[model samples]
Target: MGEFLRMRRSQLQLADVGLRDFGERRRVPGLRRDELAQLAGVGLSYYTRLEQGLSLNASAEVLDALARALDLDEVERAHLHDLARASRRTGTRRRPAPERAGETTKQLLAAFGDAPAIVLGRRSDVLAWTRTGHALFAGHLDPHIPDQPDQRPNTARLVFLDAHTRDLYVEDWPKKARDVVGKLRLAAGQHPDDPRLAALIGELTMKSPEFASMWSEHRVRKWDLATYRMHHPVVGRMQLNLQTLNVPQEEGQRIVVVTAEAGTGSAAALRLLAQAGTSSGAGSARQAARTARRP
Candidate 1:
């Protein structure tokens, strides 16, 4: 709660990006605390207390008005609203993790040929993957094992907790973590009834001190344009562009496709991955035939 208030303050600062974004280049003093108070239709001292999170009981109407007064963009406005909701449950009991992506979804991942694809559950759990995808993106471990209620290798958990994450990402690891937290924050707003999201928040707050500390900051990130520099063992270094595909056929699922620019070493690396995948597919086909004959 203390952190979320501070985050709201940052959003307020962003409203005057010209001055508050950086102090050195400011000509005007930007909005004085009183000016913001006027915009929010609240007292100067009252707004100040709210910004400080001195009270955990801001009404939905006040929050809505404050967001409008601050000129919060859609994303920030939503985040401010979410913090208000979270404050409502400071002492309440929470629920269980939600249903994850299913087997048909996993089969789709397997069919993507050389493309490295991993299906993630809401909290960014790596639910399923293609053998080639695993070989490309996360070659160090097996994917058949399900995440324990607490031990799930969620991208957020892994980025913060796993040492291997640092090696896997070339740059922008912090940005990615921020994106994870930001997206999760947004999800929390949409599914206020979801106990699993609460559990994820609780687990993250407890397990990773960095996450706990960052969660306090309340920074919200919109990942509409998320792209990463993917590092694959077989593909060497491929600049894979990421496109998040929403398939309504699979509820609570998003398929991420990783593609490289054509005619580069990455393309050749992709070919090698596809060839390796073909061999595995062949072996599986033979095994299935043998099992059918056994009956």
Candidate 2:
């Protein structure tokens, strides 16, 4: 919680908070700790303790005041509350990783033969993907990425590290990256004790400097539907609307479907990809059946 507070504070500038720069040289980025405390209407000592992790019983009113001072959005405000809750129970027992996508969810993906669809686990691991799904998103990479549970290509990982995915996003790469980190922030708050989640964050933070910088922004987002533009190698420039469906039976698992507008060029491109996926042969069906077996 303290680290998060510090990071959020560092992201603000004097101008952003309506403060004047006296043209004085400053050592720290963004607002200083005392400046934030003053703006938040809290005692300097109290706010200091809060940031130092020495105080953990802040009231809702105080948090709201600090949140306002920080100019946090709705999702960021909720994430702050979650962090406060976790801070209160600092010594709780760690929980296991959340459950994977259920058979029903995989079946749902399989049923979407015309549209590209995929099931994503809590840590953004690609649990399973349909035939058109693989061709649309990760066809350039290893086709068997979703086959191995232990080594499945995590969506977050690919977004940051894969060259092919970088080319796919082209101009809007940063937006996609921010969305990934924001969703992961919500996931991290919900599953604070999951070692796998912890490992994934740590690995990305260490390996990708871009991920590290974005993670420090402390942004949080809850996504339902988002439109994305892609520059596919084969299909050319196109746009698709992404719809996310949560699996009620499986915790932290969601199915994402990519669809284009009817009678549009984007839709034609999607159809082309689906048609090409048909040539993947009997092996595609076998892979779908194997993925369905994973409860």
Candidate 3:
């Protein structure tokens, strides 16, 4: 990867940007080749050979070592892999995915209707969902809506552009918007070429000033913990702790669970509310699923 990229022979010299310590009183542009090599724990000559395109056969381990030294993130790491594959003239056709959430996760979600549990796809698409999860995650305007891709209440769009979400949250709508935009930014960086994701971003950018402003900040991240107040239809006003668990074996999928303290009216309200639209939701969801599988 290094050798092939080096072969490009760009006019701009880079002996300044990655210097060990700002290249105090230095002459050239970015970090000198040896500096990069030393920082990467690689031999100066060997790294020079890599930079000069004399050697392009560095293994994955070597590439990873370099990436770490340069502070490359998940997206950057994946990008490095792509560069290496392209350099090697290898056609990287990924195996067809046999990947999906297992029965255990589905069961776990079904059992966690204590508040709400929603499973989001890699790009925040509403995938399989629990009953209350749909209502809690998105207002239950209509159970039949999820049947159409256009009708699904995307978490990103809702938090950023929807008037209902803006009005529904009792506090910190800006904070929530930032979090949603930040998560989407992270996903965008991680999956740069995803058409659906690209489309979603384009839509948001065109539609919402808040989203457009937040996205430009380049703060790509995830939501590990979030607590917020909300007005629930089935219940009323409540405070819930939103917990997120990345589903194991399901790459890019997450189970978001909301909870309230036990013995409180909030907890009772949550439980009752979760059951409020469940049975009918399940029937509708099953029907939708069956329809989807039909020819």
lDDT of 3 at 46: 88
Worst 10 residues of 2 by lDDT: 281-290
Q: Quick one: how many clashes does candidate 2 have?
A: 0
Candidate 2, residue 220: lDDT:
87
Residue 209: error of model 1 in Å? 5.1
TM per candidate comes to: 0.70, 0.85, 0.61
Prediction RMSDs, each to the true structure: 8.2, 6.8, 10.4
Q: 152 in model 3: Cα distance from truth in Å?
A: 2.7
lDDT of 2: 0.84
The digit string of per-residue lDDT tens for model 2 on 73-103 reads 8888888888988888856666865455667
lDDT of 3 by residue, 85-188 (tens): 54455454343232244688778778775558877777776665776777666654565555566666678888777667776574767777877876786666
Clashing pairs in 2: none
Of 1 and 3, the candidate ahead on lDDT is: 3
Residue 6 lDDT in candidate 2 = 95
lDDT of 2 at 237: 72
Q: Highest lDDT: which candidate?
A: 2
Q: What is the lDDT of residue 284 in candidate 2?
A: 48
Which candidate number maximizes TM-score? 2
